[model samples]
Target: MSDLDASTPRIFLARHGETEWTKNGRYTGTTDLELTHHGIKQVKGTAIQLVGPGKLIDPGRIAHIWVSPRKRALQTFSLLFNNSSSSIGDGTTIAKTKVTITEDIAEWDYGDYEGLLVGEIRAGRKKRGLDSETAWNIWRDGCEGGESAEQVTERLDRLISEIREIQEPYMNGGNAVDVVLVAHGLILRAFAKRWLNYPIDSPLPLMFSPGAIGILSYKNHDIDEPGFYLGMALPLQD
Candidate 1:
């Protein structure tokens, strides 16, 4: 019999490396782009920081790792774990882990303005009589070529439920391990919002830079059970 615990799981979320589009301040929604050299190095640094002191992450306990279906994200995941590859060194304890490619975890789909910048989108929205604020915050207003805020919430909610299932053993203490998620900016922010049980309408001003990580601790709420709180954003700078 397999006993899965969903009571207390700490989800470690990371935003994938920076892409050319992201460097240009363009909306990278669904548009796949490769990460810059600097971006690649940035994510590698995050891996180093995790194993450092003051942080309680046990590399061996990371049982599962997840990344978006995009090439950039996949590449970042590979590089981050490349040191663990048995082919790389004579003898190194490369933590055995499984990387899962998740599709629903993709960034917000920016329908028509897929490659356009936020400024450009705002200008267009204004010409079309849409409120500038609304246009700027398409996530809140559900703009012309993008997903509505509610839709984003629904998608993230479903993803979170699945993530909990994936890390069920860890959550229930069946597996003394951690789960790593390599996703995008908005997706990570959405996870934060859901983790804190924040209002659905709250604007997500928290920007996750390339290689930034956010942690969330989940606990079943009960009369005698105390909830847990995870730490805030810890940026992995160059």
Candidate 2:
């Protein structure tokens, strides 16, 4: 952004709000679902508090936006931008950036485990002897019919490359330039890892909550340096 101190291009990763499955601790993907009422309210509040003139994220600074094809993710994006209107409270307007539905940022395709809870999946695997001493983890074992962590990493890396190609110049273009991605929890966490050039096999320090917001930027206004974790907006309790 023009007002920002550095030329580092900032990325805003907005995790989609809560869904029925998420509320119940299920692995939701592929089977598109809508946000819960509280989820809608969460994202709307996030919008009003973070995006606007002179806010934490200036709407005018956004240059590109990518949203998941899933309905929940799209709904979250809608709620984020629909915080207000003419003569409304706070009057936060949506960014003019074109929103693209990207498969790259879509939730990790949970496939066979789409509607199953983690505990259930693990118990099933243990029952079938598919798992032994270790509990099931998507980052490594992945779903039987779903994408692996390596596959997810590949896709996210490609997306990051493209984002850099498009936003690098804009970052140095001497004007406001930030990118926004609205997607699911796991995928966005994977994205954060890849954004920081971390190996997919590494343990992630944090898990994103539904309707969470995290930022990624260069450590020193230089892309060659490691990416920095700026901060998050409205972090949910574990």
Q: By TM-score, who's the top model here?
A: 2
Off by over 4 Å in 1: 1-8, 51-57, 84-97, 132-135, 166-174, 219-238
TM-score for all models, in order of appearance: 0.77, 0.87
What lDDT tens digits, residue by residue, belong to model 1 across residues 122-195?
88878888784544676466646567778888877787666666565555566655667778887777767865
- Model 2, global lDDT: 0.77
Which lDDT tens digits does candidate 2 get at residues 91-151? 6455444678889999999878889988888888888898777788888887888988888
As for candidate 1, its clashing pairs are 5-172, 111-145
Give the 10-residue window scoring lowest on summed lDDT in candidate 2.
229-238
Ten-residue segment with the worst summed lDDT in candidate 1? 221-230
Report residue 194 deviation for candidate 2 (angstroms). Answer: 0.8
Q: Model 2: runs farther than 4 Å from truth? A: 1-6, 85-97, 170-173, 230-238
